[model samples]
Target: MSENVLHLENVTMQFGGVVAVNDVSMDVNEGEIVALIGPNGAGKTTVFNVITGVYAPTNGRVSLRGRVIAEDHPRGKMRKMYAAGHLGEYPRSVNNTPDRITRLNMARTFQNIRLFKSMTVFDNVLVAKHMHLKANFFSTALHLNAREERRMREETMELLRIVGLENECDEIATSLPYGQQRRLEIARALSTNPSMLLLDEPAAGMNPQETEDLSAFIREIKDRFGLTVLLIEHDMNLVMDISDRIYVLNFGALIAEGTPAEIQSNPDVITAYLGVAEE
Candidate 1:
């Protein structure tokens, strides 16, 4: 079996004449925290989109566990789905849908907080479990079976405990402190039982203390859940502290890849940020 859980081979994405990601190839090995860091508009998020099936690459292949997951679409399905008004129908191909990717054991949190303001913290996480629950939509809609509902509640509680938010499970999602909201987003993602967790700027807008706490929480969740985390972060302290390996991007291309220590010493990385000549 391949050690890598995710792989991108010679991937490229173009918007008009601008190449957002250019022939970038990378991999995330199982049980590792890989950080993608770069200056603004350096294609870090573009790479994330390609991995999560948000955008199809124009040039290359994306694989999961050695299986080809995405290829260039000869005919875009979104156009047809929109024209036919069947955009919510079942996905015809793996590459064309985000749910298909989530079902394949990949889950992601957005850069922005997308929690349901009116829903309780527990309910937010519970909603994510709908993807894994065996009960059909009709069963849920009609409340036909007590067994399914009971099982769903139990599983939801379990996920809440995993994220250390069990105590505040009944609080409205928006009422929680900023740091806890970040953790809730992660718990919500975990309800799907994903093998890989993609966190987009988990530490964004956090204060120093909050950031430190979040750093510890991330490490705890990775060990307890046995997750391979791929994070895009601008917090140098957090990235250098937690990531097992680091990949740097600049202007939509991979400019450096190395361990945190190695990256800190790389002349190009330093130059990219400092714009100073190396001695």
Candidate 2:
């Protein structure tokens, strides 16, 4: 296995004539928390889109586990293979589909909470297990497979416990406090059994105390789940405190890549944010 779980090389994406991401290359090593941070319109989320198959890159390539999914040449034709139902052949794609990526052991949380608001907190996590559940829809709908149904419920409760939400299993998702909702989102994503987790602003709308607890929770889950996390966050404190390495993007291009301490001292990052040279 490669040391890196995800790799993007000279990747670019454009909407009409507006380039959202340009010639950006990055590598996320296994079991590390890598933060992608930049000001608005810096193409932070654009990079995420390309990697997660939300948008096909106009140029460049994306690779996962040594397979090229997107590239500048004929190899970029892997996208066609994916479209043709040869889903197992490609690990990356210029236009890879999201479902295929999820099946590849990569799962992501959205910038906005996307829980089943009408469902219980436990059900929110339970829904994710559907992808891995072995029971057929027919068996589940008819309740003919008692064993499978029981197994699913057990798995769901176990996942809730892992996220520390076992007690809130029956509460409506929207009724949970904001911070717990965020934790529920993480638990839901984890139910997919992902090897690589993509978190988009997991700390958004969180108070200081909540963010503090979230920071520790993230680290704990990373260790417990043995997951490699690629996070997009604007909270400098959270990013600096938790990420092992940081990648800074500006104007759809990578500006700097370094450790937290190094990024804290980088003049370009300060300039990009404050529009003034560091004293």
Clashes of 1: 0
The candidate that wins on lDDT is 1
lDDT of 2 by residue, 13-90 (tens): 666546677678899999899999999889988888778888776667788878765554213433342221222333
Global lDDT of each model?
0.84, 0.83
The true-versus-predicted C-alpha distance at residue 168 of model 1, in Å, is: 2.0
Model 1 over residues 1-279: C-alpha lDDT tens digits? 338898887777766557677777889999999999999888888888988889976657789888778865224542432211112232323474778899999999988888989999989998887887777778878888678778888988987887789999999999999889999999999888898999999999999999999999989989988999999999999999999999998878888999999999999998887778758
- Which 10 residues in a row give candidate 2 its minimum summed lDDT? 81-90
Model 1 residue runs over 4 Å out of place are 73-94, 276-279
RMSD per model, one decimal = 6.4, 5.6
- Displacement of residue 137 (Cα, Å) in model 2 is 3.2
